[model samples]
Target: MSTTTPPTHPQRAGLHRILIVGGGAGGLELATRLANTVGRRGLSEVTLVDRYPTHFWKPLLHEAASGHRDPASHHIEYAALARRHGFHFVQGELEALDRSECLATVGPILDLNGNDVLPRRLLRYDSLVLAVGSVTNFFNVPGAERYALPLENVKHAEEFRQKLLTACIRANHLREAGAALPEPTVNINVIGAGATGVELSAALRNAINLLSTYRLNSLEPERDVRVRLIEGGPRILPALDQRVSAQTHARLAGLHVDVLTATPVSEVRADSIVTVTGTELASDITVWAAGVAGPPLLKALDGVELNRQGQVLVDKTLQTLSDPRIFAFGDCAACPSSIVGVFLPPRAQVAHQQAVYLSQSFLRRLTGKRVDRFTFRDAGTVVSLGRAGALYQGDFGLGLRSLIVGGRAASGLYAFVYRRHLFALAGLTRMAIETVSQWLRARIRPSIKLH
Candidate 1:
């Protein structure tokens, strides 16, 4: 219960302290931008606080889970990023917030053995930005939290990958020993047909095929490995255009993925899943990608208005309704699309756009210029279908006309999104080096991680 005081920088005296909580996509980018601009010239002091020591793009979690990409190679250390960008990094979970005193209290850090590493600390700030991302919401389904794995972060993705490998190896060993089991197959159930679930199912198909091709497992991937994608809705990718959804559905079907639409999972068990229609499905591993709600810390923050899903309610400028100095964005903030009169969808694109807008707004505020409201532009949606391909749907013009594209061209566009994010974080020179290094590494390393 010891209280730790934050270190002070003598050179940064009298400078406005801008504290950003959560080092997710939007928060990290905003911190980098502010550090490069305001903190570089000593206009303000920027500090980023996050629970995790490293960051991996959320969209790539599906690839990590399927062993197509190793998260370690893709993740960036927060401390190194802070040093390179001229900002400060604080590693701790947010415990409490005192809005009147403009102070944020971070909980103590502990080692794996449960030994205290760092005592609780208090961070003082002139302006606070909350970009703490969302967590999986099981909607109180029985046994879901106990049995199912949620692919919300790098750790979860790694856990799933290990579990998947273990299941395959064990099944292979049993078959080699001439053991006959009632159910001689490895079944994986992915709940929810959104982008995460669909993409994960597709990637799993590729990984299963590779495992069989390399003779890593004795079981036939095409016949023994069963992947079921269950969606409560009438069709997959409900938020996207109908044409794009149909294309993705067809692609998944061609990959031998069993898509069960209009079927809601009533409960999850250790070895099976029960649907609302009184049907039982075999599931050696269950993954929950159904829905998301803001982290619990947001609801605990006093005075901040929260939506039904626990997201912070903010105005067009992304400022919280309760406090002018407190702003929130990304998946944790419910920012309204003034043009369309609806809340912005929780996506990487929305978070990236918000980060850019917030950076500009802060710069304008420093120069006594007028800060404009955030207007969200619809840039379309792209869903990756692993080796099968990708589906792209967007309005090419400013109007509502729909344009759909699929196959290799759509996959290229899908990859461009991640490349754009990397370019934003690392400048052109560093990004080019990264691209070339990745290309070289691919030539030497195995396509999928075996262990």
Candidate 2:
């Protein structure tokens, strides 16, 4: 009897091309795992495509904005990592997908000098995964989109920092010369009651204070600098226990950081964010940290069932119901688990756990073994409210306040989160060396970026 090895892709002459789209948390880790098997072993050619040329853990963007992190020094360049990990890195916004034909078009790459780096190219893949992640949900508040910056990535945070500094310096100069002070200038208004909004508001306030001390002697940062966090919800960090939110509220209040819950902004402007109560919170900087929605591109894909928000709906095995040949997970995917009742919410925990599940599932497929259903382990929430410190949760759904830590201890643990991520990717030996090196570098130089 003769047996045949099935071709990976019908169009492929022989080679199997496995393309994983999006370099976000789940996508990147999945690519790495598969690369160790397929790419390193030469059974498959793995390619990771993303709009950005590098990858930064999405959770730390606020700290990057606060001058606590240097993106240039910390981010992992996708090109470098791909080369080291036995995968190909391709940078392009996904233009179109032809699932039936197993074809994808990655187009129109240009160089800094306006030369064509790579022309419109077609890729063939036997299997595909979508992990494009998500963006903030502005909820269509009047003028919000036109005015506020959203904390989408490190670039967005860096842009906000630069603009905020310029506003501060210009205002200070005008005040020193006895000119009329700029009204509604340099005040930052952040919308949303979630963790990102709360933490970013606090981080920005701290950064503004530090900026004033180092570069703006002419400006009274304490008096002139203002941060208003407006949330439609009754309290900040509503996802966490009431005690966590209350303690965070107190810490922020002690810093004179304005926290207004249940007060929704009716309008936003280039220079101010106006509340429904008719209070014009003068702001030169506004941030939309509200909520998240899936990318709109997923709706165009053939045979992929998507929710109203464009989230690819998947089964407990993390396989898309419409076509099991493709799988979508992470923030961009609505992976439903039996335990969660509804779709699993997009959190770092969700993404991390999903990656592990997907990797194992793929391994099981190759070995002809059974795949386990994904179970979301709800480990409490942690909210970092800048120098005011942090909050840790206890019990998954009981919402217990029995276990809590904040201040210096909480801050240290907050730093540990990113360290743990790096450890997972690079192993303990590499992460330990990196931790020591970063500490030494900080001691040798000024802690904050002067520019």
Candidate 3:
């Protein structure tokens, strides 16, 4: 490890550096769009600063963790994207913000191969946007941080994929070797019934099916591989409309995933989750896909107004409640949503929509024109339950009541959501490249990693 002094990008005396701290869906779009205009126009410069050098869509992280998808086949290199979009990409964590001095210090960058890439840096900005996303909230449960894995980013998802496949392989090995491992069921307890949890429970089951077909025929029956989707809410998909939630419930049940609602986990142990009902959920793999909370650094940012969950509070204009120069959006920021009568739920669609709005708004500011407040159009919701099927609710245009479709059609639509995003980011040509690459990977790679 190497530690150096502070490094700050020099800002022109009058021009503002449009620094964006997070490179998630919203932040990346905002920075790229702004760079295309203000950065190239020389009216302002756009710099996207992220903890990671590459950005993978957060929604697909679940699929990656379940081995249903691969990260290498679907990641955007931040440096390359910045260059392509006319911005600078900086890799560092958000350490602290000196709002008084208009300066923020970013945490050091370290390479994966044991070398210091860059040290803490102080970046001064005239206008700053914090698109930092949220993290899995364990809610202070005992052994949760110690044992349960969280699916936060590409790195976290990639690591959890190994844990999942390892559990499957170890259970099969112990059975064949005639040694009973502690929890012989290969049980997996998935906390939270939100989109990620609901989707992953189904994906894990589907992966086991593929594993048996191509690699581990000995583990013939997947019912033996127990998957319990535990949720604290009254039902899964609590954020979506009630009808959509009901549809998702039936589809998950058809997949034979144990859907446990109204069941809150009290503690996560070495190989199980203790429920409020006093029953121990025997799980060799414990995944916390539960609720989300903002990062700790957001709370520490020099008196910025934040909600109880620690997300930055922004008005309709996407500017923070307290700060004038700082704008916010995405999982880390609470922007007003007319449909919910409160802050909009942090969905990738909402973030992407807000980025489009903010980019135009910021451009207007650069040209000394008036900016408009953002208005989110609720485009309905869709959730896929692996091979079992999908649940979708949304309007199809023409002011008609949005139709909700399920089973195969919903599954296809559910998948199209991510595809639509890639099309926007990489266009048709790059998407074709990604498609061909994953198909080849699927052929050569094991149906499952088998640990």
Candidate 3 lands at a TM-score of 0.92
Clash pairs for candidate 3: 395-402
Q: Which model scores highest in lDDT?
A: 1
lDDT tens readout by residue for model 2, 1-451: 1122222223324446778889987788888878777556556677888888888999888878777778887778888878777788778766777888887766556788866666666667777888989987778888877778888898898988787777788887887888765443457777886888888877877777777778777777667777778888899887777888898888877766789998888998888788888888777788888888888767667678888777888888877887777888899888775555577777887888888877777766655688888888866567787767888875545544457777787777778877977776666898899889888988986666667
Clashes of each: 0, 0, 1
Could you give candidate 1's per-residue lDDT for residues 309-419 as a string of tens digits?
Answer: 999999999999999999999999999875455788899999999999998898888878999999887688889988898888887666665889888889999989988
Q: Identify the runs in model 2 with alpha carbons over 4 angstroms from their true place.
A: 1-16, 38-43, 112-115, 179-185, 337-341, 397-402
Model 2 residue 46 lDDT score? 77
Candidate 3 achieves a global lDDT of 0.82
Tens digits of per-residue lDDT for model 3, 301-390? 887999988899999998998888998899999887765558788798899888889888888998999988798876768887766777
Q: Each model's TM-score? A: 0.97, 0.91, 0.92
For candidate 3, the C-alpha RMSD (Å) to the true structure equals 2.7
Cα deviation at 297, candidate 1, in Å, is 0.9
RMSD of 2: 5.1
User: How many residue pairs of model 1 clash at the backbone?
Assistant: 0
Candidate models: Cα lDDT each: 0.89, 0.78, 0.82
lDDT ranking of the models = 1, 3, 2
Winner on TM-score (1 vs 2): 1
Candidate number with the higher TM-score (2 or 3): 3
